[model samples]
Target: MESNPAGQGPALSGNVMFYKKPEPLSPEAHGSLGVKRIDQPLGFLRSAHAVPVTVSEFGMAAASFPVIFVGNDKTPVAVMGIREGQNLFVGADGNSDQDFYLPAFVRRYPFVFASDNQSDRLLLCVDREGPMVTDQPEVPFFENGQPTKFTNDAIEFCKEFERQRRATMEFVKLVDSYGLFEQKSVNFTPRDQNGQEGPQQKIADYWAVSEEKLNQLPADKFQELRDNGAIGAIYAHILSLLNWQRVIQRALRTPPPGQPLS
Candidate 1:
């Protein structure tokens, strides 16, 4: 989930990788705001550096992106590109590459669940800048001064997402409790004309479960992690690191915003 540009901090409880202009959805302010369904609802995501993901998406998303953790609390994020302001998955035509798993974070765009820190209540929000948002939505958000089916569905989706987020938080806390997570980083190098490897370039840094520490856990702790389904997600993340090379290849084939493709 993207965060409010007002610097209210992370857009989502766990991750705030892509949110830029989040505004609370209100009946009075957005009464006429309707979202127009477009074939390319994700065009704006072309510029996203990275996106949040649910624990359920670990396996599928890991197959396509480098799943890593961010922030002091260790929020998990799918590495989309090796550089900032770039996303190799989005083509120059501004369309997400076909046949790829779409993370729930992006799929829930335009509408999101925001927490009112003071009230400790969850509120529905919309990205005023979202490309899918419009005054001419095929489905209106409000009808006769009341929320329509579209708004209702969005609320349901957001509510479910927030619930999943809480579950993910517990999982992260579980990993942290065991002290199994370690800071992770990667490097890249290109071969020179003569086949000599160039200077190693650092790609990105994040946290991940340490395989050694994970393996060294006590029986009870290990079982706890297993019962909670953290083991699979941890290994999935470890395996996804191999796909870093795959992302490198894609970056070479189609570069992101700042870095050009080879």
Candidate 2:
């Protein structure tokens, strides 16, 4: 059998030469390539004869198109754009089914997109296994989202997800120990009957006192707290403080301190 070139595929018949774009183009341009639109929630675009494209290249064009869903069953997947920067984020959906992002096995694979505008496409293929779609009712979405589903029975997707969550919590606590969430405040409260305020009350009475005391705690102690569950709580507290800080800062910057807020 005759072999196709490394990057080039089989040639076309007649005087016409098959030319694949070096990158994926906008969905609107799909018509030019004879690609048909599949009416799915994810908004996938399909073409029978088109070649597969690389993720990076495909992403550039996919990002340009407003359609959130695009892909073919021959390549069961969805390509969507993430607003983080300019690059498009590609995802996979199964057989017109929902819950694409919940697959844990999918995370093991590095996403790929079409890299060229020509019909020839590039894709980053990973050997990692994926989850098999089962008849089980789709996992319910709730307060604590369901763990990623893995199609491959060989890998435990839930375990990996938990590990990542724990690592993230640890990092958050480390950041909170630096007093990054501390705030200044003024308030009036009564002291003890003996006219002597308790250390707890004093700390609350003077924001500077609390700040100084927190600062005195050894860095090692803070690290230890992070080793415990203190980090997650601290992270949550710091985020809350950050939001309050922004609100107060905006109020102070505006015309009147007490002016009816905008």
**Best by the TM-score measure:** 1
Q: Which tens-of-lDDT digit does each residue in 1-262 have in candidate 1?
A: 2223343443334234455666777666777788886776677777776788878789999888889989997888888887677777876666787767678898788777776665566667888777778888787878887788878888888888888888889889989999998997888876543556667888888898889998898999999889988889889988888888988877655544554343
lDDT of each: 0.77, 0.28
Relative to the unseen true structure, what is the C-alpha lDDT of residue 64 in candidate 1, on a scale of 0 to 100?
Answer: 88
Worst 10 residues of 2 by lDDT: 200-209
Q: Tens-digit lDDT track for model 2 on 108-203?
A: 322112223343433222111112111232421111221222222212332354354445444334444454333344222323445554342211
lDDT of predicted model 2: 0.28
Question: Model 2, which residues run further than 4 Å from truth?
Answer: 1-87, 91-155, 180-262
Which consecutive 10 residues in model 1 have the weakest lDDT in total? Answer: 1-10
lDDT of 1: 0.77
